[model samples]
Target: MDFLTLLQLLDTTVRLATPLLLACLAGLYSERAGIFDIGLEGKMLAAAFFSAAFAYSTGSVWLGLLAGIGVSLVLSGIHGLASITFRGNQLISGLAITMLAGGMTVLIAQDWFKQGGRTPQLEGAARFEPITLPFAETLREVPFIGPLYYELISGHPILVYIAFALVPLTWWILFRTRFGLRLRAVGENPASVDTAGVSVVALRYSAVMICGVLCGLAGAYLATALQAGFVKDMTAGRGYIALAALIFAKWRPWYALWATLLFGLFQALELRPDLIQQVIGVKVQVQLLGALPYILTVVILAGFVGKAIPPRAGGEPYVKER
Candidate 1:
């Protein structure tokens, strides 16, 4: 492949990787805290529509981003109330939230946007611009490395970098900080944490809220970074993929990133079916490529990679005795 062509491939890979990485981390945050976050897909979809609508209305992507996060927080809070406060089944509550968000987004879009469950397209200026550092720009002029720079980092949206940056940040927060310690403790055994004077309810609530924020960002990234607008059901089951990455990663942030990247590679492969066919010397149908990741997820999980241990007290609400 030519240098520029290689760079373009790499750039496209990063673009594809961004949303998955963000969603994986968002899943990591909630599941790590012992909350089953099956509703992530719904939460992201809701945020995507709201973010796109807000951006279209205010002509400001930043405002849209804020609105997206705000909406996700509200939805997640309702999830917390249902699952945590009412002791509702976590899986059921999450699924309900997902259904609610999906239907609500479409309903609102149809009612207000006048685009039939779609938002207006955004301007180029409204989306995030890729940052090109001076060194990278200079290197781009040098030939091979220039193309490599472009492929790897040159033209990605700001959130792409942030997603990569978050992996280590998540690891540090989960492993090194006191809050992380408490969060993990709660997940592992809220009753124990409660007996020790920590408020389990408070910790779980905070965890879900953080989940909301990250999922909101994931949604906004999908709408603003991956595409310039929103459509009905735009998440396309990526949220489920993110949850799979969490389970596959065994709840480690760095491992989650690796898992997400593998899925991203699968997606990149699907997007360019001809390349895979040429490399494999067989004609692989587009449908097969699309199904590959989920198939692999089931296979990997069944084999018990990383032992797939969930939090001991996951999905259980804590109620202290008076």
Candidate 2:
């Protein structure tokens, strides 16, 4: 691709990657705390529908975001209660939650909005407008930094910045802080953490809480920032893709960023159907581009990622005595 085309591709990559990054980090937090949450898709889908529904009704994106977070947190609580408190099977609980959301979001949307499983298109304050960073305009005339900043780095919604910022913060939280130490400890060996007076249940619940909020942001961004409104199955399989990225990155926060960006690049390729055809003399179907995440998931599952070991206690319901 040409330089301008490359820049455009990268810009789209950043936007597309933001949600994946958010969801990936969410999974990182949960799995790192010994929780295997397969319902990331569910929480995000529910949050997307609720955020768009509320935003359309209230004409406020902030309200929409809060609504999204609220629903996601509720789902997270259910997961926590089932797996951590009641000692239910984590995988089953997560799958049930996902199915519940898949049905409930569409059902509720149809009953309330009558838009065939979607809210009315959001507008004005209901949407997130891109914010131009400082000096973006002034630096537009400068050398390489100018176009790069103005076109690629600046003029994104605030959540984009937040998603990128969370990488360093997540690293710090997982590696630098005492709570982080305990969290990882619980994931690796809950008995040790419990022996040290830490509550394994509490740590896992906190991880779920953080996962919920991040997934909420990811979903909200899908409805209010990336698209104008929510659609049926809007999140698609991004939640699963995030899970795969978590595996691909070996649960490292910084690697999650790069992994999500790689997937986002595939998504960006969907927008330019002719570009790939021109480069390779073979046309690629835009719809098939969506399968990249699934392909990656399969590859990872098939042991291409042999060294990507998960937390020792992952997916096991922790019984304090056991």
Residues 1-322 of candidate 1: C-alpha lDDT, one tens digit per residue: 4556545555676777777778888877777778888999988999898888898888888999999999999989999999888988889988999999889998999999888889888886666656775587667677667767655866677788888998889889989999999999999988888898988888889999989988899999998778989999999999998888787787888888888887777787777777766667888888876777677677767875446778888887676778
What are the per-residue Cα lDDT tens digits for candidate 2 across 119-144? 99999999999999999999998988
| RMSD values, in order shown | 1.7, 1.5
Q: Which stretches of candidate 1 lie over 4 Å from their true place?
A: 1-6, 304-306
Error of 1 at 285 (Å): 2.8
Residue 236's lDDT within candidate 2 is 82
Give me the displacement of residue 31 in model 1, in angstroms.
Answer: 1.0
